[model samples]
Target: MKKNIIFDLGGVLIDWNPRYFYRSVFNDDARMEDFLSTCCNSEWIVAMDAGLTAKENIARGQKTCPKYARELALYDEGWHHMFGGAIEGTVEILKDLKKAGTPLYALTNWSAEKFPWAKKNFPFLDLFEGIVVSGEEKVIKPNPEIYKRLLARYNLKAEDCVFIDDNAANVEAARALGMAGIRFTSPARLKEELSALDNRPSHK
Candidate 1:
């Protein structure tokens, strides 16, 4: 029986709209994408989130794109925009699930630096039974290790847990680990998926 629900922070719960920086105010997706493609995918920041070097990452992000540093300045600004509050129906769905006595958890590949801002701004996420952020562990999701750790913490069997993430690679990773997963697209679709799960009454 499924007793736990895990969620992805960005895109799934919070809306990650990168387009917010450009179309609304600045014309910078092209620049940001270029920077992300080059230096943003560093393991050092990953290590920072895993609770490694706190000061190192701040310096690294600063140092990574020294030549095109202004692009980095907008990194925080861009993320703030992409991350809107929780999806409209998500808060209500979480409230309903909580009331129904369901066990809910959050598993996100978040940055130690950025998520604090998110937590400060969004409290709905504070309701999870547990939150596993990659930045804290220096290990991101879809990395089988992180999933395994979450399973162990919840004392859950893969079949008895369903994960929802905004990224396809994340969803695939969950399935690869023998768990059920849904790739979240919209609040309505997520609602439908959750509602469908409620109707089925899983047992395993």
Candidate 2:
């Protein structure tokens, strides 16, 4: 079977970062960094991504950090400000793979509430044959169960899939589960690495 390509959406294909939105929210870079690190950090995001509704997360954040209530609420209200657009180089690669008939899929750690916005903004997301979102599943990556869910749902053998993720832990999890893994750094590097993987003789 031709290798099925699984992509991690955020850093790999979409340029999503709270910093982009927060930069405009706070005038001082130091203050912005401190606020992000303190209240609206990655840990908080993980909870939202792991099936907690944005409304719930925002409320919890406000309760825990009342000083930043406005900022926390803005996290959901001004959510569109977080996007920097598609990584065009990676998008071009996706188009090429589509042309070559490679089965494509996405397994992303994204909030379910905000995913509709992404679907509307990024037409390229439609290229995927399937998308397993962490928020929808209530499970996040670097966890073997989530990976298994994707394989089982798609009826895909782990060995037949090539998972690409920007997070080292996520890529390692895929590799541990018998899927070929690529730690995505740049689109150029990804293209070269994927080409090399494709050229290799399949074990089956």
Candidate 3:
């Protein structure tokens, strides 16, 4: 039986960081950090990833912190500028896996509205046999339902998949469901981990 390798898009295959784009908006690093932590935090962004539209997200942010309305607006307007591009080394590994006939799929926590932009900007995303976007499903990672949805929708078995994610909680969730899970640190390390898996009898 061939093993399926599931990948996380942001932080693993793609470089995505709000700070990358926000640095130019806020001159002071400390102030930017404060604004990001207080006004446009991860918790708020996760709501967007879970299916909230950019317009709604911006409106909510504005309501929460009207003083940072300009910054909140930029989150929607300059959203494409947030991506730093593909992690080339990890992309190389993905290509090698494809060349070797391994099945590839992606499970990403991304806004449905924003994902089209990423799909347009990143060519490698086309390589996946299938992808499950959280925003499209109205569920995010670390949630068992989303993972189960991916497996069920694709007719894939948990035991036959190896899930890779940058978040420890997400990785653990995959493991909990009986799939091999890897907590990605760097591309080089990811390559090493996958290589080790390739040598295993189950993967063969």
Stretches > 4 Å off in candidate 1: 22-66, 74-82, 201-204
User: Residue 52 of candidate 2: its Cα lDDT?
Assistant: 96
Q: Candidate 2 at residue 186, lDDT?
A: 100
Q: Where's the lowest-lDDT run of ten residues in candidate 3? A: 195-204
Q: How well does candidate 1 score on lDDT at residue 68?
A: 54
Please report the TM-score between candidate 3 and the true structure. Answer: 0.96
Cα-based lDDT for every prediction: 0.73, 0.93, 0.93
- Where is model 2 more than 4 Å wrong at Cα? none
lDDT of 2 by residue, 50-133 (tens): 999889999999998888888898998777888899999999999999999999999999988889889999999999999999
For model 2, the local distance difference test gives 0.93
Clashing pairs in 3: none
For every model in order, what is the number of clashing pairs?
Answer: 8, 0, 0
Local lDDT at 179 for model 3: 100
